[model samples]
Target: MILKKGQLSDAILILLILLFLFTPLGFYAKVQLMRLFSFAPSIEKQETSQKLTDYNWQLVDVEGNQSNFSINRGEVIIINHWATWCPPCIAEMPSLVALHEDYGEKVRFIFLANDDSEKVRSYLNKKDYAIPVFFENTQTPTALKASSLPTTYILDKKGNIVLKEIGAADWNAKAVKDLLDTLLVEH
Candidate 1:
């Protein structure tokens, strides 16, 4: 049977539309279309390294005592970069404390505040938490290059980064616990 011109054109158009919406190529096409319409791509997180040596983070204790990362080199370290003003960071404080209670001795948990040490002390003064606190004026760690607040860096015993998470997360979650367990085993 012979098809009319309009029918054949409609069939081809349907095929193209389906192909344009169902694959990786389709996603690219959508991106290109949005670009042509003057839309910008969503911002992506900056990539960070997974090696502890990549970042020379200064160490500290709850009393704001300065130290070296080497002191905790032989143990797994959970480096939490936080600020008092950050709501999510504040919200995750209890979870972090709970995490410390469960694995504090096994792993070296450090809460590195990007604010003044006094500010951190004042904040913790009201809480019954037991996590060690430290202060870092310059927040440039190779393993944690995140420009966002509430970033948690999980480092192995040798200080190598095992995982980097941005935004607030339940530290007691199984995924996080499993990852920390693996790092502890490596230690």
Candidate 2:
């Protein structure tokens, strides 16, 4: 059929829109939009063979008690870097809390907030989260910076970074539990 020029343009425009909406480009666009709005991205698991550096980092508990991170080196550690203003950070907290409930005694969970004690405490109190919260009292090491909010690191007993997730993750996932189980068995 012979179509008018205006009608042809409309058809082409619709075709291009459909192509963009149905392709991987659309998914990428959506992810970027979500990040802009502070929505957490899907879990992406990573691992590294690098050993953790001994940074003189100090963490204070809710009761004003202080402790050095070095003391926990020989134990399995899960260190999470987060901020109250970060949406992704807020998004994955529930999973972390649940994980804590299941493995609190067997693992060392350290939540380092980018904000001050009062803000972190307020946020935690509002959410009624039982996970231990702390603020880093010293300079954070460059190696520990995973370049993203809600960055999490799972360190083996020997203080090696075995798993590093750069975004929000399902801490209650079977894979995570299995890994923790294996680590628990290893000393």
Q: What is the lDDT of residue 155 in candidate 2?
A: 86
Model 1 Cα lDDT, one tens digit per residue, 101-167: 8888888887877787777777788775667887664455655565787788777777666667676
* Model 2 score (lDDT): 0.78
- Which window of ten consecutive residues has the lowest lDDT sum in model 2? 35-44
Q: How close is candidate 2 to the true structure, as a TM-score?
A: 0.72
TM-score (all chains, Cα) for each model: 0.66, 0.72
List the global CA lDDT of all models: 0.68, 0.78
Return the number of clashes found in candidate 2: 0
Where in model 1 is the C-alpha error above 4 Å?
1-49, 54-57, 60-64, 137-139
* Model 2 lDDT tens row, 129-184: 88877776677666677577879988889878888778766777777888888888
By lDDT, the best candidate is 2
| Residue 82, candidate 1: alpha-carbon lDDT | 88
